[model samples]
Structure formats: structure tokens, C-alpha cells
Target: MHVIAERLIDDGVLEREFTLGEIPGVLWTPPSASASAPAPVILLGHPGGLNGMYPRLAGRARQCAANGFAAATIELPGSGDRPRSVDAEQARADLRRAVAAGEPVDGEIVDRLVLPLVEKAVPEWRTTLDALLSLPEIGGPVGYSGGVIAIGVRLALVEPRIAAAGLFAGSFVPRATFDEARQVTIPLHVLLQWDDEGNDRQMALDLFDAFGSEEKTLHANMGGHTGVPRFAGDDAARFFVRHLR
Candidate 1:
């Protein structure tokens, strides 16, 4: 919970970079946020590598801020400046090799690559939520939005503070995630790119179907992985507003 740097973005959004122990993260609060009128928060999740993901994370944070919610994201384990795992690295190489050879990725490889991440990162996110909500300007009823859907699913099931989630369906989802998805009861807005080259579209659809939330909406669009339309983001923001506000 240490503040390392701070700046004001356009439209008076406050951006702060900080570390919680060894985990580096960024937080953005809107102009209207304050102790007297604390803002609801959105935790932004991503596939590993915060430095490469910063621009998009900042863009999403700005959108959340504009909608009157504080947004924050933490670096995932074995990502960015964090220490790398030899096992995870090997699993990644195996996955890439399979993909490059136009072969189906083995389920074991997917488990090896993603399960440990979900196990480690979910607790980190809970800790981050604890720290973020402790800030005077960031309040409860949190929403989680982004990829690494496994992490989002785990949090939605286990973290009582998270009221809703807007999940991006462009990542590799392991088999065990489907079982977890069935236990998640929070409201969900899942976005899927039908033509995503790197993602298995049917898996995304099945995962969407597996979510046990009584209130869950799927937004499947015709596009590649990075081709999520601008309007989709607007729709996601509205989804958060519906729950977080």
C-alpha cells in the first residue's frame, strides 16, 4: 500500500502507481471521488505483463473513472518485474509449440500453465481489494473486468466484495474453470470475440454457459482477438454501472 508516483490525467482523473509489498499496481480515481462521496471500484485483470498491458489498462481505467468508478490493476505473478516460474515458463513454451504446429493444446499443458496462476493470483487480488477499499476515496461493491477469465471466475466465486464481473473471453480457459464457473453467483457480463485466432470459440461459449450467475449476459461479436469494438466497451461500462453504482 505504498504510493510510488502520482499524476492527474485529463478530465481530472487521479492516477497513482504503487506497490503492495512486491506487487506493483496502478489506481485511477475520478474527479468526483472523495471521502465524502467515495467511488465504487473496478479491479482490472489482464494476461501477464503489466508494462505491455499498461496502455489498455489505463484506457479501461479512464473509462471506469469517467463512469464514476475507481479502477485499479495489479501485476500478476511471474509477470512484468516479478520473478518468473520455471514450470510456468516451460508450460508456456509447450503451449506455443502446440499452437505453432497447428495441434490441439493438451489439457494437461493448459492445467499446468493456468491453474497455478489462478491459485496464486486470486489471493493477490483479494489482498489488492483489501488495500484498495481501505483508501478513503475507494468504496465497496467492486467489479472485476478483463481477461485471464480463470482469475475472474475464482474471484467472483470467493470474494464477497466483488458484486459483479465483466469478463473478456479471449484467453485460454482450463478444464477446471468450468467447475468453478458453475459456483460463481455474481452478475456477469462476458464478451467473446467469435473469430479470435488464439482462443477456442466453443470453449468460450461453453464457459459462458457454465457460469451459475442468475444474471449473466454474453456479448459475442464477429472479430479477432484484438478487434473488440468500441461499442462493446461502452456496453461493459454500462453493465458495471448497473451493478456497481
Candidate 2:
């Protein structure tokens, strides 16, 4: 792990930008956080690719820190300093071709586009979790939020370190991931944009119905994929607070 920069931001949150291996991310800690008294941590993931350091992500981290927690986000595979993998690129190209042809982005395209990313990303998230937890300023009762909803599903199933998760349900889910969802029993807050033009509304509902978590909640709003109102985010933040704090 390499520390590239560290500074205090809004609400006295300490933002440290760094790279782990080829993955770059930002770790936000509260001003009072220390190894002797580490703060609760949340792993924030974004859709499509690694988003690196961005406003929404940093804003969420600041909110987490202000509410007495630490938040971190890592670069996903095939993005950022790393180039897109051949297989992932091919899948994306194929999806584009199908979408341009007015064909639904389902079936083989779903497997091709979603599975490869899921296969690579879930373990990478787990690895990132390991590295983040080893840090002195971060501690357990971790929470996860944001996209490539498949990543959230898989992490809920595999990463025992995560105490809870806030999964965005505005992306296509692979057929096999529904079974994986059955294995996830953590406290989950699943967010959905009911009128999302780009997402499969049925898939989101089906996948939510498939979760094995007894403590899961579905938060749906009438909006497009990115048109989710601020209150929905506030609801998710409150959910994280209940579990992480």
C-alpha cells in the first residue's frame, strides 16, 4: 500500500488517497480515528468501472466520517491505471452491438458482460477488504455500498468481514447470480430506481426476492438509473448508520 496524499476535508474527515497494487482509492477517516481506537469502515463500489476519486464517492465518505465511520473505494478491474481486459472489452463491444441492433442485452450477452466482471471483481473486493482492515485507522463492522450490484451480491455471500451492505439494483444481473443471492444472509439495504430506463426492472425485483438475508430492505423510488432523489441516498446512509454504528 502506498499513501499518495492525505488531507482534512469537510466535517473534519481525513481523506487519504493511495494505491494498493494497481488499484487506486481514497480512504476517509474521522479526525478522531486512530489505530488505538479504529473507526468502522465501509467499502464503496461504483458501476461499470473503477471511478477512482470522485465527488459522489468523496461526499459519501465524508458523510460516513461525519457520522462516525470510515469509507473507502477501490478501482475495479479493467479501469483506472489498469487497461481494460481483452475479455471484458469484448463483452462490452458485443453488448454495444446488441443494443445498437435494438436487441435486449440479455442471454449470452448477459453472461458475457456480467459474469466476467463478477468473477474478477468479487475476489478483488475481498482482497481490498483485507488490505483496508489491516490499516490502523480502520476497523470491522464494515458496510458496502454502490454498484455493479453483482459485486455487492457476491460480497454478501463470500466476504464475512462485511457486516452489512447497501446494494444498488440498477444494473443487469447474471442468471447464475440469483442463486448466489440466496446465499447472502447479511443485513442488506437494496436500492432500486423503479422507472430506470436503462435497467431491467424485473431483474432487480427478482434478484431482491432471491436474497436469503432476513434483514434486507428494498428502497424503491420512481426515477431513472441516475435520477434517484437525494432522500434515497439519505435513507441508505441511515441504514449504514444503524448497522455500522
Candidate 3:
């Protein structure tokens, strides 16, 4: 895998370093020029433990780019490019508050900071979608893949443009997450492993049951938390092409 640390922005689709208050993040985009045609766009959310550019995720992003899709992988507030550690009690308190409020809690405690970063991210992704649609080379569909951030599946369901999604060893926080996940109406493809440490098989089963969409497919592999070694990357690419396109 090739790693390059640089700010990225293309046309109206901007991929640059951004900060949500004190939290720093990286953004991505498609071409900016407007045209008659529109292409699909995907906003990728990375796994919790790994950085955005983890080998598996990097491979997936490259595959998306090679397959004529605009894919952007962004690091979560507390992970990669931005790291801050809090006491266990503080962390538990924040998690509790987020559970109570039904949203992501990032940053210092007591402030109850609920950044609308994902909400804001939707428009940025839409801008890239518009740019992609304008391009003559892309005439197919658009979608998203939560490389490890399966929680984004719930978010994608609320958005109108996300036609499909691919999630690998996804993490769904709090029990209420399944309730939000049930609202998803698009095709959702989940890849889970039996021995995975991050997410258990039962969670995947529950998510499968919670999904309201009739077009859901679940694949259980032999690998552990990371599904890469167990499942072939080519198979994943095929699955994306089969559903997203």
C-alpha cells in the first residue's frame, strides 16, 4: 500500500484537512465541473480501531477509484490524524450521554458536543456526486461503503442518494443503533467473521434481522475481526459491482 500525507481537493468536491472545533479530519471529493450527466458518490467511514488508510480500506478505496467511482475515506474525530485520550470514567460518561441523546459524542466532556459533521458531510458528498454525474466517463450508479464503520449504514439509509452500501466487520454503537439501522431502505451488504473481536456474529445477525430492506445480504466468513485474510478482495470488488452498478 502507498501512503501519502497531503491535503486533497478536486473541483467543487473538496478533500482537504478540516477541523471540527479542536478535532481535525480529512475530507475527499470528486470533480467540480458541472455537466449534464451525474455519477454516483460514496462517503466511506472507517473502522473504529484502525486509521482511515488501513491496508484493507486503502485497497478498497483504490478499487473504487479504479472502478469509476469517487470514494472518500475520512478519519473519525478521535482516531487517526487526531488523537486524544480521556479518563475511563469520562469516556463512559460521554458514551452514556451519546446513548441518551442518540448521536455521536466526540471531544471534551460536559460540553455535550454533537457535531453535525456527518450531516455536513452529506452535502459535500453530494457535490462530488454532481461532479461525477457531469463526467462523460461515469454513467452508472452511486453508493457508499463503511469499510469498518458499519454504523454509517444507518446514516446512509437516511440520505436519499446512497443507493447501496458495503460494510465489513461494522461497529454499531449502543443498542438503539439497531433501531436507527432498521430505517435503512437500500441494499445493504454486510461481511462478518465468526471469530472477530470487534463485532460478534450475534450482532451481525441482529443487524440482519433489524434491516427493513428486503435487499439485504449477509456473508459470514472464517476470518476474525479483520475479514480481509478470510475473504478475497476480488470477491468484495465483485460484490460492489454487482450491487452498486
Candidate 4:
């Protein structure tokens, strides 16, 4: 598909920080000459442990833009160029407090700190969705994807405007957050590697079964944790076309 990279500014929506105080994301759309009467939109979430401007996620955004959809990829709080200003010691203290309070810690220190940030950022995602839907360029359905960006999907469910969703390498959803996925009614597509480190094949199967939507699918790629099926490239494009249209 045709692809181009461009920046978007405050066309109409205000540029603001997420609740977790992350860098701002610009809204993207098709150029006026090439866009349809109304276009679909996708809100892309980047994977954890990488700069917010991860190439794969950005590639997907460009792909979506080329395929006639308005796509927005937001940098989560404390990631990308705006690394978390919170000191390591202070972050450790927050984790200690959370653990002492009987919050789930699961042997992963990052989760302890990131969960709270995800919690705070959920409402910001909601507001972003509202703003996206309000744009005249976005008229079709909405979709979401991130290798580990399912946390954003959990938050996106709070808004009814989202019509479909896709998750890549999303292995964990805390028990408290499990209810969020269970409540969504739209179609869901999950892409997972056969040997993903974070989420195993069985876990992906379990999540697919748990989804409330009758129209849910799980796709397995032969690649390892990061290697996805080449089909994924096309699957994602078609997934948007089938549902967003």
C-alpha cells in the first residue's frame, strides 16, 4: 500500500498531556485530495520497554494512513523522549507501598509501577477517543493495536464508540483489569507469537475464549516473542477494512 509520513497539529482538538503526564500525540488523517468522503480511524498503542516511537507501531500507523484511515499513536507516560522524570528510588518506594498494601506484585517490579500509570492514563485514552470521533475526517469504525498495548484497549472499552480491536503480543491482564476485556461487545482480533515470552499460546487462547463478543479470533505466528507472521502485515490491513467499513 502507499505510505507517507507527516506531522499533525492542533487542527481543532486541543493538544494536551495524558493524566499520567506523557508527551502529546498528534492526530493523523488522509490528505484532503486522497481521502474518502469519511474515513475510518485507529488509535494505536505502542509496546512497553521501547521508545514510544517504535518503528513497528509507527509503520502500522503509516500503513493505516495509506489505507484510508485516520490513525493516532500516543506516547504513553514516561516513555519515548519524555522518560519518566520520577527517580528510581521514588518509583521503588511507590512499589513498596503498593506491595505493602496487598496490591498484586507478581515478581515484576515494572508492572507494579506501570499499573498505576496505566490506571491514570485510562481516562486520557477515553478523552482522546472522544476527540477522535468528533473529527469530521473520522466517520467509520475505530480499532486499536499494540504489541503490549492491550492496557489501552482495556481503557478503550470504557467508551462505546470503539467498534473493533486488535491486540499483538498481549499476554497479561490483571484480574482487576480482566473485567474490562470481558465487558467489550465489539469484535476482537488477537495476534500472538507461538513462543511469546510475555504471553504464551495458551494464554492467548484463554483470552479469546473470555471475550464477550461472539466475533473474536486468535491468530498464531510462527515467530518468537517479537517475530510475527508475515500474514500479520496483511491481516491487520484487512481486519480494519472488514470491520471499519
Query: Least lDDT summed over 10 consecutive residues: which range in candidate 4?
Result: 12-21
Off by over 4 Å in 1: none
lDDT of 1 at 7: 98
RMSD of each: 0.6, 1.5, 7.9, 6.9
- Candidate 1 overall lDDT versus native: 0.94
Highest lDDT model number: 1
Q: Specify the poorest-scoring 10-residue window by lDDT in model 2.
A: 47-56
Provide the clashing-pair count of each candidate structure.
Answer: 0, 0, 10, 0
Per-residue lDDT for 1-245 in model 4, tens only? Answer: 11133444333222222322344565566654122476777877665433435556556766676677777656565566656647534665765676578775453555555566676556766777776666566675777766444475575477577788887655454444455667767887778788765554665676667678778777777767667765786787788788887
Quantify all predictions' global Cα lDDT against the true fold. Answer: 0.94, 0.85, 0.54, 0.62
Error of 4 at 220 (Å): 0.6
TM-score of each: 0.99, 0.94, 0.63, 0.74
Given candidate 4, what's the lDDT at residue 12? Answer: 25
Q: Highest TM-score: which candidate?
A: 1
Give me candidate 1's TM-score against the actual structure: 0.99
Error in Å for residue 205 of model 1:
0.6
lDDT of 2: 0.85
What stretches of model 4 exceed 4 Å from their correct place?
1-22, 32-36, 48-52, 83-114, 147-150
